[model samples]
Target: MAIDPKSFEAIADLAYRESGLQLVVEKASMIQSRLRHRLKAVGTDSFASYAELVCSDEGLDERRQMISALTTNVSHFFRESHHFELLGQKILPGLIDKLRAGRRFRVWSAGCSNGQEAYSIAMTMLETFPEMAKMDVKILATDIDPKVVSFGRSAVYPERLTTGIPKNLKDKYFSVQKGKEGDEYTASEALKSLVVFKELNLLSNWPMKQKMDVVFCRNVVIYFDADTQDRLWPRFHSLLNSDGHLFLGHSERISEPSNAGFINNGPTSYRPIVAKR
Candidate 1:
C-alpha cells in the first residue's frame, strides 16, 4: 500500500530528528519503495502501522531500522579519483616524515558505506608508502547503519561492485573467491589490518579521542538540512589536526568555510585554519 500522507510525514519527521536525514515529499515514492522490505520485516503491510511502531518510545530498535531503510548507502571504490590523487601526491608526502618519526597517522572514512572508500585509502597508502605497514597508520571507517558497518567488516565485494578499483590495485590488494554471486574479491589481510570498521551516527557524540589527519565524509551531508550541516562543519574542524584535510562530496560545500575555521585548499577540500600568534 502507498504510504498515506500522514504516515509519510511522521516517518519523514522522525528520520530528520533521529538521523538528520532530510526527507522531501518528492522522494516519498522512493522512500516508500525502500521501506517496503522494512515493513515486511516488521510484519506490517501498512505504512501507518510501521510508522506508528517506529515512532514510539517502545520501538527504539525499529526506529534505527527505519532510519537505516531510509538512508542511501551507495558507494564505490575510489568513487572520486581526485581525492585519492590528492592524498597520494600531496597529503601523504607531508605526513610520511611524521609517521616515520613514530607519530600516529589516522584517517576517517565517515559515512563509509560498505567499506569501499576505506579500502581504497588503504590501497593508496600501501602503494604510496609501503613501510606504513610497520608504522602506526590506521583508517577508521564508520557508518550509521550497522548492516553496512558489518558489510564493511566482512571486507568482501562482489566482482561488479568493484569496477571502480583499478586492475593493478585489485590484483595486489584483493583475493579472488568463488561465491553465490559469481566471483567475489576479499580485501587482502594487509588492507584489512589498516582499517577498522565501526557503526556510528554522525549526529551522535563522536567517541574518537585522537584528531585525524584526513576525514572523508563525501556524499553524506547533502541529506542534512542547513542547520545540521552548519553544526557539523565546526565539529569536523575541531576533529582535524591543524594541518588536516576535510573532503566533502563534490555537490556539498560549507557556506562560509572560514566561518567554520576552514580554508579551502582544493576541490571540495578544506583545511583547519591555524590561529595567528
Candidate 2:
C-alpha cells in the first residue's frame, strides 16, 4: 500500500528528531519501502498504524529496529586509502612515541559500519608500529545501529568483501572460514582484540572518559542538517586531544574549520589546534 502524505511526514519528523537525519519528501518512497518489512513484522497492515506504534513510548525497541533498517551501512576495508596512508606515515610516528613514553593511545571510528574502518585502523597501527600490540592502544568503533555493532563485534565478512584489502595484510590478519553458503573471512584474534565495538547515538551524550588522538566520522554528517553539523564540529574539537586529527568524508567539510579550532591539513583532514596558555 502507498503511504499517505501525512504518514510520510510523521515518519520523517520522527526520524529527524531521533537521528538528526533529514528525510526530505523525495525520500518518502524510500522510507515507505524500508518500513514495509517492519510493518509486516509488527503485524500492522497500514503505515499509519506502524507510525503510531513507533511514536509511542512502548515502541522504543521498534524505533531502534526502524532506524537500523533505514541507516546506510556500505563500507569496506580501506575505503579511503589516503587517510590510512597518512595515519601510517605521518600520524602514527608521533603517537608511537607517546605510546612508548607511557601515554595511552586511542582512536575512534564513529559511524563505523560493520567494523571495517576500525579494523583498518588497527591493521595500519599494527603494521606500522608492531610494538603497539604490547602497549596500551585501543580503537573504539561505534554505530547507532545495534545490529551493525554486533556485526562489527563478530568481525566476519564474505570473501568477496575482502577484495580491496591489501593481500599481504589479508594473509596476516584474517583467517579463512569455510561456510556452507560461501567462504567467509574472519578477522584474526589479534586484530579483533585491538578494537571495541559499541552502539552510540551521535546526538546523545558520549560515554567516553578519555580523549581520542584520532576520530574518523566520515560520511555521517551529510545526513544531518547544517545546524546539527555546526553543533558537532565544536564537540569533536573538545573530544580530541591536543593536535589530534579529525577526518571526514570526501564531500563533508567543517563549515567553519578555523573557528572550530581545526587546522586544515589536507582534503577532509583537520588537526585541532591547542590554545596558547
Candidate 3:
C-alpha cells in the first residue's frame, strides 16, 4: 500500500507532538515507505487504516519497532572525535587533579546508544586513568531502549564496528571471533566490566544517588523540543556535581541562559556553577 503525502504529514505531526522528535518534513516519503512494509506484514493497503494501527492500535510490539527504524542511531567508536579528545586531554586530567587524593571518578553516559560510545569512554579512562582504576572510576551508561541496552551491555560487536579503533587499543580491549562472516569482534570482558548499563527514560523523574564528574549526553537532546530541552537541563544540573562538566553534541549546544547555573568552558563544553557553602 502506498502512503500518500497527506497521510504522511498527518502521522508525522502526531509522532512529533507525542515524542518531540522533530522529524523533518523531508522524511515524509521515508516514513510512508517504512510504514508500508509493516502494512505488508498486516496485509493492509489503505493509508487511513495503517495510520490507525500506528495511532491507537493493539500493536505496541510492532509500533516500538517502527519507532526504532524511524529514529536515527548513527554512532560509532570515537565519534565526533574532538569531544573524546577533550575528555582525554582536558576533562580527565583536570578531574584527576581535583580528586587525586580522593582517588575517585564517577562519570555518566546519558543516551548511550548501542554501547559503543559508553565503552569508548571506558576505554579512554582505562588508558588514561589506570593508576587510579583501583579506586572508583566507575561509568554509568544509560539509554531508554531496552533492546539496545541489552546489546550494549553484552559488549559484543561485529568487526566493522572496530573500523576507527586503534589496533593496539583493539587488541587490548576486544577479542576477535569467527562470526557469521568468519570474523567478528567483541569488547574484552576486562574493559566491558568497568561499565554499568541500565535502562533510563530521560523524560521522567530520575533516581541518581550521587552527582557525576562528567556527563556525556551527546546528540540526544536535539530530538527534543525547546520545552523538553528546558526541562532536561535542570535534571542534568542536579545530577552533576557542583563543579562537574557537561558534554553536548557538536551539532547541539546549550540553549538555556547562563543564569540557569551553567557556565561555558567553550562552545560544546559546559560546567556547573559551584555551589556556595
Candidate 4:
C-alpha cells in the first residue's frame, strides 16, 4: 500500500529527533521513494509498521539498514577543490619547512561517506610530498553509516564519481573499468592504500587516540542542531593539535561563542588561537 504523506513525514521527524538528522519537509518525497524499496525487500507495506520496526530495540539492525537506504550519500572526487589547493599551497609547504624533524602528519576526514574526499587529500599529498614519502601521513576517514564506509573502503566508483575529479588526476591515479555498471574510474590501489575508513558517529565518542593536524568535515554538520553543533565544535577543537586546522562545509561556517577564539583563516577554513600562536 502507498503510504500517506502525514505518516511519512512523522517518521522522518522521528529520525530527526532521535538521530539528529534534519531532512527538510520537501525531502519527504525522497524518503518515501528510498525507504519504499526497503519496504518491498522486507515484504512490509505500511509506513507505521515500518516505523515501529525501526523504533524497536530488537530491530536495531533493521533500523540501521533503513537509514542506509533513506539517507543520500552523493559524494565525488575533489569536493570543494579549493580546500585541497589551499592545503598544497598554504599548509603543506609551511609544515614541511617548519616541522619537528621526521614528524608525522595526521588528518581526519569526518563524514567521509565513500572515501572520495579522503583519497583526494591523500592523492594531493602524494603528488606534493614525494620527498616526504618516508614520513608518516595517515588519513582517518570516518562516517556514520557502516554500509557506505565499507563501500567506500572498496575504492570503486562509477564515472559519475569522477565528475569533479580533474582530468590529469584521472589519467594518473584511477584505472577505467568498462564492464562495471557503477563509477567508471575506480580508485587505484595506490591511492586506496593511503586512506583508512571506519564507521563513526560524530555525535558519539570519537575513539581517536591521537590529535590531528588537518580535519576535513565538509557537508556534514548541517544535519546537527545548534546545541549539537555547539557541543561538537569544542570537541573538534580539543582533538586538534595546537597548530591544527579545521575545515567546515562550504555552506557550513562556524561563528563566535560556538567557535570563539578561532582565527578567520579563510572563507571555509578556521584555526584555533592556539594554532595561530
Against the true structure, what is each candidate's TM-score?
A: 0.98, 0.98, 0.86, 0.90
Among these predictions, the greatest lDDT belongs to 1
Candidate 1 vs candidate 3: the TM-score winner is: 1
| Number of backbone-clashing residue pairs for each candidate, in the order shown | 0, 0, 0, 6
Q: Sort by lDDT, best first: what order?
A: 1, 2, 4, 3
Worst 10 residues of 2 by lDDT: 94-103
lDDT of each: 0.93, 0.91, 0.76, 0.79
Clashing pairs in 3: none
Which lDDT tens digits does candidate 3 get at residues 1-277? Answer: 5667666766777566544567666766777766677777767888777667767767565555556556566678888777678788887887776557775678888889888888888888878777655666788888766777898888878877666788898898888888887677888766776789987767655677888888999898888878878877777888888778888898877776475679888768888888678
Which pairs of residues clash in candidate 1, taking residues 3 or more apart in a chain or in different chains? none
Superposed Cα deviation of residue 105, candidate 1 (Å): 0.5
lDDT of 2 by residue, 208-239 (tens): 99899999999999999999999899999999
- Kindly list the per-residue Cα lDDT of model 1 for residues 1-277, writing each as its tens digit: 7999999999989898889999999988999899999899989899999989988888899898887888799989998899999999999998788889999999999999999999999998999999999999999999999999999999989998897998998989999999997999999999999999999999999999999999999999999999999999999999999989999999999999999999999899999999999
As a TM-score, model 1 comes out at: 0.98
C-alpha displacement of 191 in model 1, angstroms? 0.2
Per-residue lDDT value at 231 in model 3: 74
